[model samples]
Target chain A: MIEFTMPSLGADMESGTFVEWLVKPGDAVRRGQVVCVIETQKGAVEVEIWDEGVVERLVARPGDELPVGAVMAVLRGAAEPAGRADKPSPPAAERTPRASRPAKPQGGPPTTPAMPAAGRPRISPAARRRAVELGIDPATLVPSQPGAPLQLADVERAAAHPVAASTTRVAPSTSAEARKQAMREAIAAAMSRSNRDIPHYYLGTTLRLDAALDWLEAHNATRPLAERALLAALQLRAVALALRDVPALNGWYSEGAFLQAPDVRIAVATSLRGGGLVTPALRDVDQLSLPDLSGRLRDLLTRARGGQLRSSELSDATITVTNLGELGMESVFGVIYPPQVALVGFGRVVERPWVADGALVVARTVHASLAADHRATDGAVGARFLTRLAEYLEQPETLWKPES
Target chain B: METGKLNPGALRKILFDCIASVAPEADFEALRTDRPWREELEIDSFDFQNILIAVSKRLGIEVPESDYRKLATLDTFVRYLAERMGAAG
Candidate 1:
């Protein structure tokens, strides 16, 4: 039997809520078909199953949060025996409680609308949690079903309208505000852990960018709007290429040791339109052409803002790159997202005075900085990585046909 | 030929539409025209480039990278496009 499990997104993500399943039992599934949608800190991600089989059993409901590596479904091999397909699901260890729900009273999954058996209003655990986050008292909400247990939807519907009938001062924050608060708390927790655990070393450099700008101008002059690669994409490509020269800076440092990752995935720090930020990594940056990379970046941004990023894109970055340059910052010494050892930052390109071949001339340049964990790599390795990065930028034509 | 009849009113409508297309989540009714609309609306430079590209296509104008700074705000963009469009006529 093939077991479909909940895939972990980022280092911080512990579990994901199963929104819905695309395929049902007895359906023959092919490789790479999106089987389910999982809600994580990254937003609603369509999770794809890579194995091909006939689905036998679905283990979780819509509201259940499947923990990392938790078996979400069981699929039978096409050639296997038909009689064994009736076998029950695996033991209780795989069917863990949803992280949002409080600890269940009588162990095992809540097969029923089980509430605190002793309470008067017998509120469902999820409803009580939702009410707390929405700043509404669970007791204040009226259940839609008279005798049935109060569900999460009832609390949400009640929170939609102001609690004017009640006397408690409810926080004047909406669902969006609550979500924003949650995202901020998540970021704070990650960054705080990074500061407390990792010994960070910072390095800064100024690179003249006339050649890169000129190459970009020439490349984009005749191209259509969709094919144009922004400077952000170009910078990412350069970073991906530069990582080859210094592999130590391209992987995660965990458990007092640096673990090198094979593929060079660069996480981009993209800002959401509504609020908050998500660093979704582009897979295999070194393999993409400038135009292709830019197109992917464009698509990534649209999906990120639309809250439709896939589960595969949210996890497993070797490094993080931020372009505050686009935001018009002179330079930024950013915090490194944990597990990943380093963060590469680029500031806005501005025209500055420079001496070119013993003659003073005005040239456009940008400041790039690297914040790396000291345990992973020393300053010299980072300096070399920066030097290679600068070389790639200064001679921009090479980026189009970068050496493998 | 479609851009020959371009007026400030039409230009504003097109600008709003382009911005909307790039960032559909932006609250256009409360958006301020005089301020730097890109930052105000949280349209990053990449997405902002998308807006400019769409605008340039609709208006039949070629905006060089150098003049991107000159069109940061709605008033500045309308003024910049109007002058060039008049010169073309």
Candidate 2:
């Protein structure tokens, strides 16, 4: 049986409230299918299952709070025999309820309870807390079987049909506040951790935007509005193509080493309408054409603002690009998001006097800044990446050409 | 000069439709032709470019980057397109 657990969407996420289940018991689930929605600090994210199987049972119910790594459901593998359902597994020792778990000795920090014995139904700590909060006695709830222990789902079921009239429903507004607070805390923790751990190196370059803008204008002139590519899309394409020449800057810094990502997933930093930011990945950006990228970017931005971003988009980004241009900033020196080794920043494009080919000229220019993890890559590599990025932007027409 | 005469009302409708296509959520009825497109419609440079592209495609005229200044408002864009189409004919 494959146990589908609550995934840690980010480093700072500790626990999430089980908002709703999109799948049911005995439902056939394919890999990468969204089986549930969990309300996190960021928002409600549709969680996708990575394993293909027949769902044996859902261990958590709607409104049940669950911690990271807590098992949400169990799925019977496609190869598993259906006859196993009638056959009982070997008996094991009963699990000690959370309230009865032995306390640590004096002067010692309290320790977590020992892992439940094999064959026992696994219950999450958050679930136990939730049961207490709801005034539901876990002991009164029946387990799935004689050998199995009572789980959160059983407690939830009992709470729903309360024998006592004292049970209070958690107010939706209070939960929403809790979610926002959790998101703020998560962002704070992640940013703090990044500052504390990662050794960062910064680089900045001012590139003339005449070539890119000219190409975009010429390209758009020939096409309809729906088919025309945006400047952001073109900039993203340039960055993605530049990563091909300098692959060292396109990956994560993990385990004290730089692990290059297999594909380029450029995470575009999009500001949320609710006063926060999210950098969701545009997968395999190097392979997508300008028009395709433009469409995807528009869709991604719309969904992000509506709080409908998928779980994978949040976690799968290898590098992040923050454009403060729209906000009218001339330049930005950004803090590198941890795990990801590099971040690229773009300031507003403005007209300025330029000295090109020994002649004074007026040209549109944008400041491109890079913040890279020093532990993963040095100044030379970062410089090379920026240089390649500039080259790609200068020769913007080449970006739309078919990849050789 | 045998292509066709530029119709202001027809050109205006086409421009409005193009802008609507780029920004589906925008309230076209409330949009002010005298005000700046960005201020009135909350559109970015890319969106503005798309609007220009739409006008170009429908009229079969090339609106170069240098002519972008003339696309600031509905009046300016309509006049620009009409003059360009007339010149082309």
Candidate 3:
């Protein structure tokens, strides 16, 4: 039996919002098959299976905020005896599976016919819910026969559109209020778990930004307006590259097992839904060009802030970077987002004292606070990662050059 | 589209329009100044952030999602706009 736990996509991603499950109990899955989608604030990403087996059970559901290492699904051998119940049990709190959870006031789960009619089509649980929300009948929607079984679009056309009313509606009501409450509840649950379960050790380092700014100003002078991007991307790219030298920081920790991941997925902490948080990934940042990285970051942040991000965008992260600088926060000691070994927090850039030529000099510097899982990375490893990152940022010229 | 000068009534209408666009079935009449909207409105975190886009479009101002959380109620939300537009002062 192989436990298909929620793999940490990035270092700072302590928790993830379950976006969707690709397979159900009894479905055969091969290694490297994209099995699930998790939404991080950065964007949606499909998670590939590391182990091959038949999905025995799905413990979590869409919209569930699960810790990094929690078992999302259980996989068993094809020939393994089925559990006492072959049918997947619904979530304990709700009788309906996440995919089929009714948006309407239905008291219980929907009943499907024992057998399908010749023309009646099958639909996914998610698409079914979407159909319900849109007041569409899922049974009428044709399931995709070529490849994927069901999707939102399949369900969308099946149902008639709700009565279109003028934009002017009344003020707040129970529906809106209930959604807000649910979101708060989910956030509170995730944060409490992260703070309590994760062992966080914070180290603050102030990096001199004078040289970096000089280099950036010169570089930007020749670039286009759209090319001018957030300073955080440069900081993130540097940190990501530096992680290669300090491999321990680019990994995950679960039970007594410590694992190193070759690819680096950085979660850019983004503010969402007026009050909530989301971390979208900038995949393989080390390989992307400066303009490309900046553009991707802009798009991810726009979707994150705008709430158009799909569920997969929110979850798959291997590391996280939180920038409080935009909020005018001088410094913050971030809670290690779990499973991933480290989180780097960037504080506001301010003029500060620096040592140059054995004398105290005033220079603009940004304070970087790194929080690491004490169980995985030692202080030396964390320090080396930070030092190398700082060096890269200070020498921004290397970032513009094409990699060998 | 001034940075912050929308009338209180205009802002209220805008807020209502925003919610109505997303969840049309949601009852807006029940929302009041002290309704604890986070519980009463069912406005999930995503919806709350999406409102910023609407608010920005209506007011011609870029309202940060993080800043919107501080406005807890419909009345407070309107008041926030009043302040932003310098109308309240």
Candidate 4:
């Protein structure tokens, strides 16, 4: 039997309130299927099960605040012994909602199927839940093909129409000032630990992106808006590939030692529409092509805003990147997220005075800065990372054309 | 006589609806038509692109990335989109 526990999404997240269970007992779950949702300071994050199995029990009830490592569900895998399938959890007292807080009412999960169709059309279970979440009537949706099961894209298409009244609604409880206050507190706790413990060293430099901007313009000229790559993707790709020469700055500072991360996961600093921010990771970024990376980045931002990020993408970050150029700031120095030793900051790309080939000219340049933990590495190592990053950005052709 | 198709007021409504869809927290009543909304609204480049994408999808008109600067304010945005969607719209 496999015990699925509440994942520690981040240092900022101490616990999460069980929002909904996508699966119930006796349901056969596939590997990588989103099994449930947990509401953290960030938002409603869908938690995925890594192992394929039949759900034997659900230990955590909806509305229960479960701490990190608390068992959420039990599953009997294909290889496991059949007899000991149902491992009963301890009584309600021993479950979540610790002594510090009162046990809230176990309300029905938010996305209850409100439709009562006489002969409902075939719809995927995930799509059904999503339709209800958007306050959409599942019966009104059409499948991709006639007589086929309705998919999430169909619900998305229906929700995208401006005439849908339900699409405009935001949950009062989720968007309330109280939730913002809670999020602010969570950020304060994590940042306080970062400042108190990490001996951070800051560095900055201006990198020219004239070639990059020119190439981007030419590249996007022929393509439609949906497939066009953003400069942010190139910046992230540069940082990820640059880490090859500066692996020292890519991992965590835990237990008084520096451990180089295996994969280059870049946690993007995304600002939520409601209020706060979340730095969710895009895994193995170094291996991805620019187009693939751009698509994934767009999807990540969309999901982050929609309050639908996954749990596995939340916690594990080898490094963080913040781009505040859109806010019109020329430069910004960010505080490093603790355990992760480095944070990269980028100012907006702007037209500025520069000397190229011994002639004065205006060039598009971005102010790139690095904040590193001195304990992990000196300023020189961080400086080298910035140098390599600029090298990648300056040669815009190599960034995309030599795409693996 | 189909004034609604090319009307500035209709264009503005479409634009605001797209913005609201992308950034629900936008205070529409206080939003100024003459201001460069990126800095004012705290919306990043991608979010703004998403807004334009939605607008294009609604009206079935394409706006190139280079033409993004032409839409500095809500007024300019409506005007630019109105130009793309002329009498035939």
The most accurate candidate by TM-score is 4
Share of reference contacts found in each model: 0.33, 0.30, 0.00, 0.78
Residue by residue across A125-151, what tens digits does model 3's lDDT show? 567446435544333455545556768
Mind giving the per-residue lDDT tens digits that candidate 2 earns over A1-404?
Answer: 77888766676667767755556677898866777767667665667777778888889766667998788888897888654432212112101000000000111111111121122233444454355456443444555555454566666776877764233333342343444565567677777877898888999999999999988888777775566667888788888988888999887777677878777888887754334677777876788877778789878775665555666666767788988776667998777766788889998888999999999999999999999989989999999999989888888878878662
Q: Candidate 4: give the clashing pairs.
A: none
Candidate 2 clashes between residue pairs 3 or more apart in a chain or in different chains: none
Q: Write the per-residue lDDT of candidate 1 for residues A1-404, one digit (tens) a residue.
A: 77788876655668877755656677798765777766665556667776667988888666676788888899986766655533323223212111110010111111112121113253565564455456555546567888676788887787667554251334422244445565676677678878888899999999999999889888888876667778888799899989987899987777678887777888788766555677767876888877778888888876665555665556567788988777778898988888788999999898999999999999999999999999999999999999999999999988867464
Candidate 2 at residue A5, lDDT? Answer: 83
Over 4 Å off in model 4, which ranges?
A: A82-175, A401-403, B1-5, B27-29, B87-89
Better of 1 and 2 by lDDT: 1
Task: Count clashing residue pairs per candidate.
Answer: 1, 0, 46, 0
**What is the CA-based DockQ of model 1?**
0.31
Query: In candidate 3 chain A, where is summed lDDT lowest over 10 consecutive residues?
Result: A96-105
Say which docking band candidate 2 falls in: incorrect
Candidate 2 residue A153 Cα shift, in angstroms, is 32
Best lDDT among the predictions, by candidate number:
4
Kindly report which residue stretches of model 3 are placed more than 4 angstroms away from their true locations once superposed.
Answer: A1-174, A310-312, A358-361, B1-89
The DockQ score of candidate 3 comes to: 0.05
Error of 2 at A204 (Å): 0.9
Query: In terms of DockQ, which candidate is strongest?
Result: 4
Using TM-score as the measure, name the better of candidate 2 and candidate 4. Answer: 4
lDDT of each: 0.72, 0.69, 0.61, 0.75
TM-score of the A chain in model 4:
0.81
